[model samples]
Target: MATLFDEPQKFPLAERLRPQTLAQYQGQAHLVGKNGVISKLLQSDKVPSMILWGPPGVGKTTLARLIGNHVKTPFFTLSAINSGVKEVRQVIEKAKTRAGSILFIDEIHRFNKAQQDALLGAVETGLITLIGATTENPSFEVISALQSRCQIYILQPLSPETLVEMLENAQKQDEWLKKLNIKLKETEALLNLSGGDARRLLNLFELVVSAFPANQDPLVITNEWVLSTAQQKTVRYDKTGEQHYDIVSAFIKSIRGSDPNAAVYWLARMIEGGEDPKFIARRLVISASEDIGNANPTALVIATNCFQAVTMVGYPEAEIILAQATTYLAASAKSNASYMSIKKAKELVRKKGDLPIPLHLRNAPTQLMREQGYGKGYQYAHDYPHNFSPQEYLPEAIAHTTLYDPGQNARENELRKRLKNLWQDKYGY
Candidate 1:
């Protein structure tokens, strides 16, 4: 129930100077430049339903307010964490009575399937322009029906230059800050410690500034003050929040990109953040199956066993099992052939719908099925020398549908050669 301004000691400069218009906003040049999407929308006097996807403290909530201001529409904000279906419907009904409305939902991914469905009717009929912000991947978190109705734009972290620029602007422009004789000695340490978070960087600057004795002719803001300020604030790491997803993303991408240094750095991040060892182990299992599949069949078994070991024996002992899996996965030859294959297969299903099963491959589970000539011409591969049949498995309508092309890694090179002997024409092996 405490107002932000009531707790200025805790809120700091960034919270105090949140941009009310797009013109005053910095960063996200991709979305708010002269010809940016929001800028163009302002020029045309129209705004569309949109979802802003990004990490924390990237000004998603501020941008929503900017959009509403530019369009001159009523802005109704909701947090998906607490707002329910009843609240959603009430907002939608209220939006219909207004000339135009922009419903801004923060952490929109927290909406369950039912809560999301409640917004469909209003969005479809243009009762409100919905702007949803989420830290999670919208494709996985948002309902497909709702996602299709909104244009998703990604926002990124403020670059070091941008963060420094903000600090310079505050020093030069802010009334309170300008009164102080603050001089930045070194920004490298501050920016690095801020971790590319604009809000944190600015708040740290204010802390160091306020800590200065009021009448000093030249207030020297050094790395030591910044470090000291950071130590006063104990950041409780949320295992399920921004840090968790960020660490896992870095960890997986590191293993995928073959950067052992980055992989281990993220591994240490997760461990220090107190992430569940079994959860890390499960990702390794999936990484082996999806990324290292077929390329090294042994990787799957190793990762699976590693997962079981971690489950049987919890941390800190499980950290060793995780390390062994991480090292092996990092060292193993990687291929995404199977991953791409399944993706392509799912896409084909969506595009082609359900194609008829080939009569030769259909099971003759009953007399009527056998009478329909099911399994009449099916060939048993076991009767032959090799356990493979040179027959088509795809539907007759799309008989030549081919997926699963092996990559040029050492393990997959052997697979490519074997596939060449098995099905020569499909892959040009």
Candidate 2:
């Protein structure tokens, strides 16, 4: 019954299929379903400042636009990459006139501290509602003060089922796509290549559909066709964008979780995405000390050497070295005893506020200082049997406080025994 002119006009499949309302939006049911938090918020008059943290193509931007449309309020968008403080101020100034206006910033993690600071007043004064979208962890990227003012909502990647439903919906809703006698032969290739990105699934699907002959009555979509078509188009991974952080996070977590296969795959993704070899090597070094720690001190040595080797070799050869280091670290026993110890120590320092060092533990460089009792009672371990002495190293205020708790590993278990022998009940080792 529909006329030819009523067919969906020329546009990217993703764009043409973008959900215009909450009812039309697919996936993210936990947030947008009938009883979802966002759905409840939409029912109210006041919309709070929030950050949408998720992977790419998960509809962060679309959700923001949909909220604006639902509220019937003025909506403005800016990219953190290109917008400076001046542009931000301009937007804020304009927002003042339009009460309850929403300002959406894409890739907001890229905004520096100063740039983020510019919006604090506007957000606090309720002049503009801030909606920030980021793929990076907001705790690392957003300043604490700003983060305190906004609610952070995490968006999940689309599942294969959701993605397949989206594809079906697109084919059903889009007139042009409906007209095409398209049959999906296998969905594995499409889903695997999309990596749970709905937009990518649609775009790749469109590309494959375009390859068919104009008059082909029944175009069958197969895994082979999707793979071949996708290969012909270079899929760029922006090393400086959201994908960069997502991939790196995956790489580090993979190592921490002891999955060498995953670690190598994520490492390859970074390498192919043109990530700096130094950056990759640096993370490996940190992981060595933070995750491997005393469980395998040799891990740090190997990681450090890998860094040096990668720096000297670079690129093609560096990847092999990285792979070796990644696999080794993933296979090694993991511990965060040292990492946790430092954190607890730092917290104690902040709480205690520079407690005075015990006089015996102080250095006596001059005769006058020695007369004042500096280093007067300090034990000389060399003079004692077994070159060990139980002495109060901590200040008088908190002398008995225990900081380091040896992790349950071969190396740390030995350390626990040695510490127990030296300190007795001073530390509950």
Candidate 3:
């Protein structure tokens, strides 16, 4: 049916496999399934203005299209990169006359605050059902009023299983793929290279298929081929792109993993690629608090000082401070005990709602407060021996909440030994 002379297509898979209905879309079962919010809204025909946030190739755009299709309303689309506020106003004007209209804006985060504000009126007045898609966090990029008016739903990266299922489905369904006698010898290569991006996976799949020499029976796709083909020199690592996060992640992991050599390499990669030195320093600050933690209390102090010095000094000069902090963090003993402990404590506090403060711990600055027994049983540690008084800080209901479990590193060992002496029953160091 298909000829060899056919021209290579720009969006072969994405366009062909574009889900015309919610049922055809893969992944995001949370929003499109039977009990999903989007499904319920569609059934009742109550389409609301909303924002979709997600990583690349997560069907954010496709889901927006699917919603537009199912809603029985006029739909218009705009790309924030090329469109200005003028285009936004034009769409709004059109939507004013057309009742129950949807205006979808892709990369809505790229729109500046002013451009985004232009949409607020149309969205608030129901002139258009706003469907905004953003790869960035809306809290950071979107205006407060605009964000408040739109319900935000985060779309997740396609699972490895879902990605593999898509590839297998394409192989079975695509005439060109089947005609080529394609056999995926290894999926690890594809999955690794795609980084869980479905569009990237399908594009790579198409590439491997097309690269196979003519007359080769049962064309096998191997890791070596995938690696070689996908080995593209990344364009000047833009901190705004996914590679930015990936490289920063590698840099931090290298430091956390105690590989100063790899850490410096990633650091250089980011710096030479024009990453903000302050941004790098900020991550170091966090790495110091999170990974290096109580293993080296000096780490937090050093990183904090570095951040301050870098902020005052600026780049080129600031780079030295970053390097100094990075090296120290890389060479330091690592511990995440404090980080995990606080995270767990915060999670409990959030889940259990606002818990009452311990009566003894509360301040009795007023006479009426003292009458309520506030600070009645409070102990003055400074007045006690060794300037240490064993007392409960958490609420009585959460008295047993064992947060901040220090690790067994040298610095924490000192804390562990001292704490055990003060509170023998608790803090099983």
Q: How far is 37's C-alpha from truth in model 2 (Å)?
A: 1.4
By lDDT, highest first, what's the ranking?
Answer: 2, 3, 1
Q: Per the 3 Å backbone cut-off, how many clashing residue pairs does candidate 3 have?
A: 0
The 10-residue segment with the lowest total lDDT in model 3:
1-10
Question: lDDT tens string, model 3, 56-138?
Answer: 77898899888888877889999998998999999988887886699999989889888998988888888899999987778
Model 1 / residue 145 / CA error / Å: 0.2
Answer with 1 or 3, whichever has the higher TM-score.
Answer: 3
Off by over 4 Å in 2: 1-9, 233-236, 240-250, 253-286, 296-410, 416-429
Backbone clashes in model 1, listed as residue pairs: none
Q: What's the ranking of the predictions by TM-score, best on top?
A: 3, 2, 1
| Ten contiguous residues with the weakest lDDT in model 1 | 1-10
Error of 1 at 265 (Å): 10
lDDT of each residue in 58-95, candidate 1, tens digit only:
88888998888887888899999789999998898888
Mind giving the per-residue lDDT tens digits that candidate 2 earns over 49-88?
9999998889999999999999998899999979989989
Each prediction's total of clashing residue pairs, residues at least 3 apart in sequence or on different chains, is: 0, 0, 0
